[model samples]
Target: MMPLRLLAALRRMLCLCLLAGPALAASPTGWPTPYTQVSGTSVDWLKTKGWWPLTVAWQPAFAGQNATVVALKANALLSRRGLDARFVPMASGVAVNAAISDGSAQLGAGGNFPLTQLVDQGAPIRVIAITAPNLKHQVIVPTASPIQSLSDFKGMQPPATIGLVLGSSAEFYFQAAAATHGLKLGRDVVLKNVSQDEQRRLPAELAAVVPWDPTATQITTDLKSGRAIDVSYPYNVYQGSFFVREALVRDVPDVALAITEALVEAELWLRLNPALAADVMAGQPELRHFSRPLLAQQLAEYNLLYKLSYLYPLGAFWGRQNTDIAMWLFVQGKLGKPLQGADYAARFADGPMTQVFDRLGWKIPARPPYIPADFWMNFVGNTLPAYDTYLTMKGPQAWPEPGDLTKPFSFAGKVHTP
Candidate 1:
């Protein structure tokens, strides 16, 4: 007494099974075949689900700073390992963060500024690893212009406009430079929201452009009139981080671990073979617009490192720097308020990355102490008084400590619950 609907459904399933044949019987139960292998190693849990062709979002810049190299090599590494993944180029870090936030992308890579902003605003993502530090961001002016330094832009007869993308690290550093020169943003000088493309056509009225490479390199190299005046900040160790959605970390941690391992390997490869790495990065479709020489020049400027042993010295400085930037944003009314130490801990998850290091038997490096308050005060310019007062009130709680991987993933001594 089988129901007519049930019988029809059964018949269709039978036909499908018959067509599928012995291949169906031999096939693994749930997960997609040949997509979960990692460097020729396979994990049983990775075979429990069918997540294939992992999507990574990245910002395509001629500068080898973004995860372009890592993403490119990771695809090949995974393919060699029998997994499949691809990196989708987004317009900017903001777009990449949005893509991960909306679940369109499982992972992303970018500078700490936009990524931190997204996490502060409750994006369902966590920074799993810090790939590199000390990326060069500069303020460049035409060689023939009277604006030789940041101070020269102050009190011009006609207000000068600097071209920079809004909500970027360039804007932050530009504001810092103006503050240092006793000038206020929007009053002493104006800022125009210009994209990388628009920067090439910089107007006569534009005093300078604050940009990260390869735009910075391209402009300075192509225009004989261009001269780089100043680097954005002194402790110019701003970092690039890898971010993944919580869902991916929660559901497919092995996949996350595998990707992290692949990236670490890729980083080591890039460091060992800069020439080959440059060639590989330049070959990417997003970067084919630029010449190989430009790509090599940009690559020369970058110092990418991912070894767990190097994390402490770099992470300590970067954590303090990140907190300072966050405080600056809050004071400027860009952020609602300064985020707490626990909040930063929740944003950065070092466990998965540490596990990879442990698996490889790499020794963890010693943790470096936080940078003194005065050093930060000098770095932030005229905001010293306000920053000093804020620090006194909050204590040193917001500054992150070098995480103890042996215990758990914690920042500023609090466990990261997320």
Candidate 2:
């Protein structure tokens, strides 16, 4: 024998080296860096997937995601569900729209603004589900500000610095709301795009943030700790939907249905296991903006929102997308009239939306939800809060009536805001 002691030492070294290899490959230090190999080799199996194997193009703002976890767990879910799919990550709605048109991805998630843009572009996609009308508008005033109601905005200035998740479906609702209330953002009041982390400071000047999400916990905590308060109504009723390419609606409707089934199941799972669901969802890097309590509240809110309109609202495809919003925004001048009538439905395939209801053995209700909250919001929390879609304005019993075609009213060839 070479030497018993030396042989034992060599074996231990080999074991140590084996353990060290993966740690080195993982790059325990650095900014989510790409995995590196110890030396030049035929292949680096450890880093084969690379960073963010996702499509990198269609990056929809998730309510909350543990994308990393979803990435790790998704394939198994798809496999078990018999979904022959790939996560094809894309960075923007523009890219997602292109992918669907080019046949790269059959479906993707996005907000109403982009979908509105898609209709204008004449892209071949359509709405599959109305996830939830955004509840993002918030008139966040510090526990100590003088701004009590919309009237307090008299001398306010822009850059009011309200916290918001940039580029979400909530944008549309805010646009509609500000106009409805005669409040001109970036003018009358400012839209402050601040991160969730920075919000703890409770900036100096904040009239109210639009599409604000302050759950009952946040509300109660704010009351106790004296943080933000309800300057605006609690609900955001802008309609938003889950849309997909039209071809998939017909060709591979089952795949669409399968995905919808996952969403339905995920929604239920979140409802039943809230804290755990938040734990999983928090793992998603994109949705890290929210706190644990906020995330939990969102899961419950989404679960209730989706189940409200119809048992499975997605399956209720009327062969037409809701373009009334487009018309409304166009008149308001926030958008251009891209397309009109039933022709707008050409943007998507309906097989997935329809088949999902069939697969689940649930009934899809009649007519697409003109306003999702009408069916859903009433059932969301223990005591539902009032919404912002339609507000009652004071009539002749109010102000001194001043009539003037000269300046009081002039058609800007569009709907006037103030």
Top candidate when judged by lDDT against the true structure: 1
lDDT of each: 0.61, 0.44
What total of clashing residue pairs does each candidate reach?
1, 35
Q: Which candidate has the highest TM-score of all?
A: 1
lDDT of 1 by residue, 1-418 (tens): 9999999989976764554333311111111134335432233333343345667787767254453445445347555445576767787888887888787777787787886687578988877766444456778887787777778777775678889988888888778767777776766689899887677655677888887777776777855557788775352446677787776567666666666666655544454466766677666788766667777655544433222343322334455557867887788788877865456667776667777655433445443222344554453434332221111333322211234233222222333211
lDDT, model 2: 0.44
Could you tell me every candidate's TM-score relative to the true structure? Answer: 0.73, 0.58
Candidate 2 Cα errors over 4 Å, as ranges: 1-61, 64-75, 84-105, 155-171, 184-187, 190-207, 211-236, 305-324, 328-344, 367-418
Per-residue lDDT tens digits for candidate 2, residues 29-55, read 110123111221211321242211212
Question: What is the lDDT for 409 in model 2?
Answer: 15
